[model samples]
Target: MDTLTNIRTFLTVVRAGSFSAAARTLDTVPSVITKRVDQLEHQLKVSLFTRTTRKLDLTEVGERYYPRFMTIIREIDDAFQDVTSSRHRIEEKLRIKCPTTMAIQYYGHILTDFQRSYPGIRLELLLIDRSVNPVEESFDIAIGALPTSYANVEDIPLCPLPRIIVASPTYLQEKGMPKHPSDLIHHDCLTFLAAGNRWQFQGDKGPVSVDVTARVSVNDSHVLMHAVENHLGIAIVASHIAEPSLRQGLATEILSHYPVPDLWVKALVPRNRRGNAAVEAVISWLKNASQPAPPWEQIPLSKITRQAPS
Candidate 1:
């Protein structure tokens, strides 16, 4: 067995958690992945993985050896890059992870423009709704809003995304507008699970928090927006997600005088991989794309002429 190739295959299987998934990632068959793992275990004289019908788990030796193998692989790739990177103009493949909603709503053009500018670079974008750990997943960079800080990753802030409270004109008319945060209890609320059940706002005196009773709670902003459009309830969502509705007059802003917490869209890269050329290039593009005014705030609500859906 070729030791380096087998090691890489083994690492992929470990991270992917299944032979078939690893095979798809590696562009090979499951038999090939299985053979590589078998060969590796044979050579090492230890069972690396404990396989069952449901899932594959790493054994004691495999757990210890996994990090060591990863470090060696990274070092080898770095050495190869150090030798050939200077001769080329970013002729490398970049694996990027982003939220599905953001990719569809905002990042499509930015990514396409980058690809056009750098023809030599190949981009693989993975759109996932859940949180991702870039280092564990072996992705070059992960782009999304993070709730809190991560010690293992470096966060590069790109833009601010303010959370806003919005309701359809019909709903507000039927339920009456909330004069204060305390008034929210009397209204139907649609909540985003990513933002906790409690909603926070900055009032004239200080901060005001409301423990809301949700009519419906969903993880996807698109779904929540649809509910708001139908006059089901008021929703608190990131400004970007609510921009189209708000601009079209499908939804009207509530609590206009109060301030909501702002969430920033940031690039999260492993601390050790921050200086990689391809990663830095993408980050630079994102920063430039959001400058002066972020995409979410580019068009004022008053400028939108399209009528809201009935």
Candidate 2:
């Protein structure tokens, strides 16, 4: 006999007070209900009902078990209703981790658009550019150029990050341009200390490593960009950040010596929680959004409209 059938028979008989009454309530023959209750008694090794021609009553064993069964049945029904309710309601709190530099650049519009689209979801955005462990940090999503050294996470690539060197035309003209990667040593340079002052490139010979010397150094890319604009020094930075300056003829790109490693805008989500809806939404939006080149790759500064900083 089916397992749930016995449980249903127990519930019906207890509520209706007789096998005949229960069969009428269940729309099944009284004998069928009797057979199911008997099967349950045999499985449990305990008789569940005491019967007479005049009345039906619970056995001593059945009395003890009856309340538990009813409680469990109620719980099961409540659980189903809870699940159904949650499925219809979309309210969820979303938390995300992002690179500090990119967060300041891209997150403003993303958060505004997401809030308008998903009013039911609350968001927590955390900015962490350097090394971060998502599991330790308890974040729902991580956004950055995914590190290859990462372990046990879902790394979803969002966009391409073309990196290159940019310098103010005024600064470049004052110091003069470098003819080769080696010539950079003589010119004033703005550098990223995080990159270890070693610029890796794909050269005609295959791969080349150039250790650049800089007059000024900064850990932050955004600050380095500003330094270059202020004529503090020439800086190597991403194209998108330098787009406005490049358009206005403020900055110029240097030597065709080698190809810089492309930055991959990627999202790192916890492997255990990869199926979350909010994480999926941000990942999808990042993929669909416009991705412009980092300053040094495409059109020169002269073509861009110049807007002075407010």
Candidate 3:
């Protein structure tokens, strides 16, 4: 057998955790798998696995080399696929992770449209609400509204996620409107867990931050908006989430003069996958979708305008 085949067999054995399992996966006998792994280890001059009758474990050297070997194989496979398929007909499977709220509110159609455009590409999407290590989790892409600084990962900014402070008309009517950030202390504020009680904004004087208390705190932006609509309290919500309510006159924007801080939507891609054709295509697609201005920003904020209290 060739060195490349032996190396592939060794990786399969490592992933399967046993010679028998690797054989089953490759449709061969355990002895063949064992011989292949042995050949690979001998060529490398290191014992790759610490083997036992019950289980198989990678040695220290094996653990260090595994990721490098995996990267090499991925690049080789991607190259073969690129050469064989037409430029626009690239076939690959992409594992993507995105925030649950964003996925529900925005990405449903966006992702479906991408699949339609690239029929040969298969998408496996996981909707999560927190930060995850894409490399460790084996995800091709991870999208979120927060900035990330991870080693061996590339952070690509997708768009700016502007926010607005809003409350139901009924709630504002009953509680009265606050002209300034300091006045938020008197109202029952609905806060997002990630943002906490302190809300930051920019105004004529300078940056202002208010340490307000919350009547109800939640992680989901959609839920927070729902609470605001139900007259729960005031909340700092994403512009997109609050748009519909403001347009319907169900909610009113407050502190319009004091703009809330904008969070950026970013895509986290592993360094090894940065050059991958499918990953590059998806990233390019996102950029194109968000360029000039995002879809949410396309609608005139003037349509739902509310004058700031003086």
* lDDT (10s digit) by residue, model 2, range 1-310: 7866798789899999898999999999999999999999999999888888897889899999888888887888899887556434557787787766666556545666766766666778877666556777787777766344457777777677777877888887788887666676777777876555766667787877677777878666767777888877666788777766677777777765665778777777778877676666666666665345422233344354434332
- lDDT for each residue of candidate 1 in 1-310, tens digit (9 for 90 to 100): 6989999999999889899999999999999999998998999999999999898999999999999999999999999887455425787898898876677666766888888776677899998766678888887888888565566888888888888899999999999999998899999999887666788889989999999999999777788888999999988887766878888899999998886878888888889888877777788888888775875566443354434333
lDDT of each: 0.84, 0.72, 0.85
Sort by TM-score, top down from the best: 3, 1, 2
Note the residue pairs that clash in candidate 1: none
TM-score of each: 0.63, 0.60, 0.64
Error of 1 at 126 (Å): 1.6
> In model 2, what is the error at residue 109, expressed in angstroms?
1.4
Q: Which ten contiguous residues of candidate 3 have the minimum total lDDT?
A: 301-310
Error in Å for residue 95 of model 3: 1.6
Please report, as a residue range, the 10-residue window in candidate 2 with the lowest summed lDDT.
Answer: 293-302
